[model samples]
Target chain A: MPNCDKVTALVSASLDHSLPLHKRLAVRLHFLICVWCQRYLTQVRFLREAVREHPERLESAESPSSTALSPGARERIGQALRDDRR
Target chain B: MAGNLSDPQTWLEQHGDYLYRCAMLRVRDATVAEEMVQETFLAALQAKDRFAGQSSERSWLVGIMKHKVVDHFRKSVREQPVSDVELMNDEFTGLFDKDGHWKIETTGPKEWMDPSSALDKAQFWQVLRRCLDGLPPRTSRVFALREIDDMPSEEICAAMKLTKSNLWVMLHRARTHLRSCLEQNYQGLTT
Candidate 1:
């Protein structure tokens, strides 16, 4: 039986659609036995659905290019064009 | 028009940007990456006859760029300090039991975690890149080739001259470091 901490995270991950098959079954079994984990899983499911249903913020924690490159890096690419020409 | 080797400058002009971009993506440093790109172009110009087109020109440049990045990191960054958290190698294996059962609970039959959202967060991406930077040079090289560059595991094994176990160990270490880093970043905040 997974304890509270592991159960909470598993529920969170499950709500996020991240739990793998075997682990998913184990979490389901635990949820059946433990009401706290079940509620936690419910909250997670609700929040994830809310997040999905709503339009995400432009700066939400999910953008690949959000980690902006240092300023001028893209502009600096033009330097390569000029330098290689000579 | 493309077969001539006497005009090395023309070849450099034609493909220099491609070479530099390949090196930059691998090394993540603009200045040193630029030097490596120049060297790759020079080397290719000298040995253009060796190009048998086993891969596309972009991929060939990437192969050469890989070697250059590895060589540069080995020569320079390998001696830097690696944190104790990152030094933990076998802990991620704790997720598996002696019988190969997964210890973590999963709610669904998902095989992969979509960390794309995690990457979207600027703070998370910063932490992730820092964690990657902390990996041992060779391990980071292999990990970057597989994860960031999207190279096949077999290609990484061949390119890095590592065994399958070695590859998995390196990847495990990379993930462990990144996960712990992200967890630490998340632990203090109420998000």
Candidate 2:
């Protein structure tokens, strides 16, 4: 059986769809009975999903900033725009 | 938030929040992100005369913000000397034996209690962002380009001047770090 390190690396690499056929088979074969690896894979998958759904993007023109813009920064931007127009 | 682009003050009020969020995710710094958004607005205002009715106003502004983010990264990578030693650590080495066999201590991942529910919380995203910020700048940038932005690997390599192997290594390390961070920080999500 491949070590946990090898399986873990391969599993993470597979997320990019970069593993070859034989290596894919090796990963699959390892997962068949390796409960620990399966759990690890689940953790990685959950992290990916959570990251994708994170409210960091400007979801739409309507969605406001997830974090409030600091007043100082807001003032700075305002001042910069005013100067540019002058 | 989509309307006339004539007023810069209105742009700052309506689109400022959204553009700030966009830049924050890419740069992971409030001051820098705010500056980038400010720069984006300046660029947009300057180019508004040339802004043919091609894309939406927000989209056009975002395109400029993306360029600003890329420029920030390029400058950051050039200014800071990232060490290779940190990238090639023996941290995960103990998980296996010399023969590359899983050691008895290498217990597999623990079942997450309720990952999706945890993700639904607003604080969960804050933690995730913090974890991402904790990553090395170059690694975080590559991960963002590939995962968050969904840029193609070929394009990432070309744009970042990274070889395929180097890109893969960066991604692997980023994933590894994020996974560990999430597991440690979030309840019901253990590795």
Candidate 3:
């Protein structure tokens, strides 16, 4: 029987790639008794879905000035673009 | 309308900020993100003839920026040797005991009721951004590449020069930390 710590790691790994059968069974069996690990799996899955589905949410939540291009960068890039044309 | 391109002069004023933010989220560096945004625009300008107008100009620029960001990572990975110290440190040791069960008192997963609803709120996204910011730079970078950029694990391994196992461990650590951080911080926003 794998411990909760091992099972949680497996659960996280399952997201990136499919787990081997024995390890998958171990995680499933552990989840049968351990509600905490179940919550862990759910939360991680939710985190992935939320982040993946709504990346633009970060843009909306962020203050514009913080992530925006600085005036200097804007000027430099603009000059580079103009220079490329001429 | 075959050769029509959106005016390049209006690009900086219109799409510059949005492109910069997209680059920042993936690269996580102000200067590098700026450079990437600049490169993306220049590359787009040179390749203007290739634009089929199949997608909106913003989406077209975003597609180019994605390639630019990946190229940046590939080049950086080649130039600098990867330090595995952070990845190998097992930062979660305190969360588990010798018996390998969760410590529970301080580290067990908390139940987050209505987790999906939290996503609809602007505050929840803000908390998530902060949690992502809290991760070690390498961990967050790996997480962003995997989740945000939707890159494959094998590709990530090849680009970062990490073994498959090392990539798994880094992602596991990132997900665990982000899960806990969001549970603790965003729970307040929900209630």
Cand. 3 TM to true fold? 0.90
- The list of candidate 2 runs beyond 4 A from truth reads A55-75, B1-7, B13-21, B28-34, B46-63, B71-82, B85-90, B94-107
Is model 1 an incorrect, acceptable, medium or high docking prediction?
A: incorrect
Docking class of 3: medium
- Measured on C-alpha atoms, candidate 1 has an lDDT of 0.51
lDDT of 3 by residue, A50-78 (tens): 88798778754564334688999999999
TM-score versus the correct structure, for each prediction: 0.42, 0.75, 0.90
- Model 1 regions lying over 4 Å from their true place: A1-86, B1-34, B40-117, B186-190
Q: For each candidate, what is the lDDT? A: 0.51, 0.71, 0.82
Q: Lowest summed-lDDT stretch of 10 residues in model 2 chain B? A: B77-86
Clashing pairs in 2: A36-B108
Q: Sort all candidates by DockQ, best to worst.
A: 3, 2, 1
Candidate 3: where is the Cα deviation over 4 Å? A63-66, B1-5, B79-85, B88-91, B188-190
Candidates ranked by TM-score, best first?
A: 3, 2, 1
Give lDDT for model 3.
0.82
Model 1 DockQ vs. reference: 0.06
Q: Put down candidate 2 lDDT per residue, B62-173, tens digits, no spaces.
A: 8888888877665654433345753545545544577665555433345677777775566566666777767776787788777776778887776677777778777887
